[model samples]
Target chain A: MTSILETENSDNQTQKEITLIENILKKTGPSYTKYILGIGSVLTACLTIWLGLFITPKDEHLGNTVRLLYVHPPVAWAALYLAFGTTTLASLLWLWPKTRSYFWDKIAGASAEIGVLYLALTLVTGSIWGRTTWGVWWTWDARLTLTAVLLVLYIAYLAIRQLDGSDKTKANRNAITALFAAIDVPIVHFSVLWWNTLHQTASVLTPGLHLTVPLSMGLTMGLGFLCTTLIWGWMMKVRYDIELLKVVDSEIELQRAIMQRRNEP
Target chain B: MTTNERLLKRRKLRIVIVLAILLVIFGALIYEGLTNSIEYFETASQAVANRQTLGTSDFRIEGNVIGSTIKRKNEETLFSISSGKTVVPVISNGSPPQLFQPGIPVVLVGHFAKGNGPGGTSLLFLSSQIMVKHTNQYIAAHPNRVKIVKN
Candidate 1:
């Protein structure tokens, strides 16, 4: 009688365990929220392109090249401030023993990969605009040179993450490298002010937060900013999902290896 | 070691060496580039003040175009740029960019002419290229401005 009662209790316990696992799996899997964000990003990008190309007036001075303002500045802001800023904060969190987690390290790595994409876009778009307006495809001015350096630095940061190491060692290395690369962000920002560079200073983000550009141009640029940021957000979610899968797969593999060893013994 | 193990070891060593060399090259390039770009250009006033010391050296000068002084001749465009009270006469070898106009700032890349100025009162800058230096401000094309541009 006692054995039968114990077996019933064990069955109940297994049922509870299964329910818990199901809840976790549901949480980790993709949901409607990510898809909704992805759709929003696509729609906003289309709207930005439409308004930038057609609705906005040609700049009094820049003419049609003014349309590039929508592309270059927004991409640059996303790359330099948004993506790298997230990586820096996440790296700091990982470096802090109290807050250290694989979550932060994975976020840093994912954000940096996206940062590289936006940085390259920033360079390409800016180059096209420069050729039309500034009469050069590239120059060795302070701002341009520093921006190029920032790209190389982040590329190196990503490469460092690929080296063979234990998880802890890799995380530590990545976190440190991210912090080192982030030192260039402020320098790139202030280069125009500190040196004689061909690149112009901020338009909307001036010293007093004054809007230098006209209202229409400013609003279109703001929309472009929103579009790029939304795209970054959607990309981050997808990247984080992939990173979580890798972590989960490794955990499972480790468990399977231990089980096989136990069965052999 | 087995052949496979030896091959893997050789590959790892090769990667390490390549990475080390790349790191050194990158470091040197950044150092040199940063040092050179620190003072990328001089203002018209600054360039004029240092003309004696900067004789015939290739550099860039930044200034605003004096509206009344732009003139074009065969294969050359001539303009005067000013920063504060110092105005530098520029003789550019080619056509300026599309946006280049009076009252706009520009960065001219070249050096001081070998000889004296037009009247021998000041030096002339011989420019190989002209880059329009736009400000951050953006003004929409007003109706009046559009008509003016068309007329």
Candidate 2:
């Protein structure tokens, strides 16, 4: 009778542990770091707007709408190249047998969360530019289409990471999912050159291609790039910090459950 | 082998299988992009060479707008595009875009106009859309002037 009673208690304890583990990832509040990032992001955004409007020169052809040049390219660069690249590298590091680290999984998740925001901005700014320049708001053209696909793919990555699983299972699954979705980056980059599309070919590239931006325009674009990059870093740090907190929370909960079981004399 | 050893081996095998699949998928994507990717439209002269195929199916042809040839008849904007060697006459039913101008490189998307004049040749392109591609700097043809076109 005592053996049966002990077995039932053991089973109930295991069930409770699983439930607590699942519930540990509840909503979290902002910290001082999040506040700093939020303030810095807003300031940078304001500076970018000032640079674009007051300082930049009207394009020789596109006129004032040319100001979009600052926002569109920089946002797209951050999303598609910088944020996405970081996520890919983190996933790769986690997957590598020699370099596997739980920290990489958290980095991948945080960068990807930030990447979704930048990706949405990329589409919005690109659409605005297209509406003004291409005479159409959206088209099924290759470059635009491929970029839209990339946005959807990364959103899927975030969704997969949210699926309920054990910590190890989730980590393994998220790493593989991230590595798979990164395949679209090359396609988005080369879409302009590969396909005849309404979108113009890239103005900047190596091997004889030169950017002929006037001083004012160049300065604004440069400012926009720097500001967006700083903002991106700030956001990433905040996100990674929150992820670390969640991990700590989970560990504390597990420790508490163990102690409770020991005290149950 | 111990259960822990077997589990580790299985995890490694899963990683290898997943990576192999990803490699194959990416290889296919690159191959597809190379073989069947859309071509940036050919020059008007280039397309003119394959008029039989190009004229029937909707294709894109590009050239510089010829200034003297621009004619705005009521709602229609008619113009000719040139690439030094061959000039393709284009008639666009839709109104020209705001930045549309002479000497600018433009790509016309539409069908070839069938003609009975001169050795059964086609004279004009029936354009559904006109797009301009140029250098990064927008050098307004007449930068100093402000012509508020009311339509």
Candidate 3:
């Protein structure tokens, strides 16, 4: 019958698509480069911890609490600048007419997931530092408040991605939501300057570019930045692989269903 | 409906509920921040200018401590904080923090005094707490060079 032949043809097409997706997945699986990045992240992180805890001299004002500077600022940079910045950039690329691709969407999602982890660390480390230096565990200051809002905004972005929709529809929704969330980044950065805040302004990244920190502390903090960025890179590569695997997994499931139907009486 | 369709519908419902909760939390945070922490504290000069309007209500004032003016009487610590030309005398009920010193910036939480003390000062602010507000500048204390940190 014509209907039976049509169904057979559809199954054949699905089989071909599955074959193609499987090939792509095989080519894109974990590689030597990812392993190198993983090793580098671990080694650099250990070195940073050693230098921060032992080698870094006591700050004249902050004393032993100055060690937190190495952790807090680097984690903040990774979250606010490195990871979130990548998400916004990837989202922008996906929104562009010429560069629109699911690749950008996946990259945005992965970067954002990692960014949330780093942002949470930023808040935790900052709170510990705040308690020791500022004499309070928490305060409703502008910088702290806006940073909290930034975390919530990104949380909403991740939730929006979970809404049931077609791939294209989800991509569009995520891109727009990421763009909107990015509006808060600059506001959070300038909150101390724009408003009366208990939080101190930027120590190193001041307008004049003078290193507010000493040479030894600055170098250790720089190493911390490198360590965090490498960790982010390794995580991003693995997360992107997982996204690819999801596509392959769904294809395999469809292939199995088709074979089962063909075998049915 | 098929089992797949039912599962999809349930998942979507869960996501929607989560999104609603997040939305409410976000709204509450913004509202709380706008009213309470947006304007963190008034400076010493501003607080003095608006003392009558502020009345006995709890508020925070930021200023630099005048070291020479700091005095301890009984259990109370008395000090004068200045912003520009305006100086506000403060009487704290308890001992100040370890880092509390002259020429350092601090934020004091309290209200305008309802009455002049035994010394009969015309203007005085009653402080319940004092918090040292350090600056962004850092001068490394070299063993050879004695570094003076100015906030």
Candidate 4:
């Protein structure tokens, strides 16, 4: 009887040790990937600031207000990146059975949220700059109109994702809808070009080099893109982990229920 | 219908409404862009050089006050804005802005009607309001004295 009790105590201690180890492993496993991405994001952001502030020359026409273009264009691009990223991820999840749809669905959700944030920033900054340069706070520019449309669409995307239950069917339905809504992006870009509006044409890259922009401006834009991407990626990972933990907790509850039933019998 | 189906239908309806609203906004914007005249912001010097084309048309004129050209005609006031090349006469029945001086940027909104010249009454000036540009330091020092007055 004494030996049996001692063995039982030891077994309990061993089980506790194993559970602690499992928890630690789970917590630490994603840290390395997240840290690398985080560091890269910081470095890119620093590079963007350096290029925008120091490298770009003041414009002959717009003067200091030209600085806004550096910040504004990249934000617009990052928003576009988010929209595209989410749609692509959603498509992949829907197509591939092997891929866990929930994981990418959460990522899509995160990207949409961040995309809206940057899009809002882009609009506000662009409007302020427009006021100073064009003597008006707002204009009926093609590019501006398209941007507004994109913003509303993605905001709808976010709202739809949040409204329903988190079951697999619900997630799949929302992901599919998001994927379909992405069709607007190309249409927006194309319509802006076709229509004559106050918004200027794309500056950073075009088919033929008509205007020679300073190298600093390009670097600044590139840096801004990298920083926003890294931040978005990190946020998606954190959210994904939280969802996984919730699933694990539910599974543990189910195991406890089975154990209780067996003991009663 | 199930609650879920009803909710989904409502969401779809909302999306359609939003899209329609956006379309109307887009249409209005296109119309405004096409109809509104495009004008460039310029100082008095540039305005004077292009006075021929600028004649008898609504424009935004920027210049410094010519000290001698200022005169009071009863309830009406007259002044000449000099860009160094030509002096553009301005007739204002309204009170002058606080910062109206011989050497500052003052934008006048009106058309150039018959006065200063074939060059007479160079600009048939009609301004409803005036804004005096001051530095942040200047504004802080004399906050009450530097208000923008609308005529």
Instruction: Score each candidate by Cα lDDT.
Output: 0.86, 0.75, 0.86, 0.63
- Predictions: Cα RMSD each: 4.8, 8.0, 3.5, 11.3
Q: Using DockQ as the measure, name the better of candidate 3 and candidate 4.
A: 3
lDDT of 4 by residue, A29-105 (tens): 65888998888878887777776666666553445666676678777777775645675566567557888656677
Rank order by DockQ, top first?
3, 1, 2, 4
Model 2 stretches with alpha carbons more than 4 Å out: A1-40, A205-209, A250-265, B1-37, B116-121, B138-151
Across all candidates, the chain A TM-score values are: 0.88, 0.80, 0.91, 0.77
Model 2 over residues A1-265: C-alpha lDDT tens digits?
3488877887787787667555544333555766676787788788889978876667656888888888988888888888899999999998898989988999898888888898899899888887777666775567776777677678777767766568788889999999888998988888776676667766554226566666666666767777777788887876776786677677768777786877688
Clashing pairs in 1: none
Q: Give, for candidate 1 chain A, the lowest lDDT window spanning 10 residues.
A: A256-265
lDDT of 1 by residue, B64-123 (tens): 999889999999999999999999899999889999888899999999888674323248
Per-residue lDDT, model 4, residue A255, is: 61
Model 2 chain A weakest lDDT span, ten residues long: A21-30
> Which regions of candidate 4 fall more than 4 Å away from where they truly are?
A1-30, A95-100, A208-212, A249-265, B1-151
Strongest candidate by DockQ:
3
TM-score of candidate 3 on Cα atoms, chains taken together: 0.89
lDDT of candidate 1 over A179-208, digit per residue (tens): 999999999999889888899998977788
Q: What lDDT score goes with residue B64 in model 2?
A: 89
The CAPRI class of candidate 3 is: medium
| DockQ (CA atoms), all models | 0.52, 0.20, 0.56, 0.06
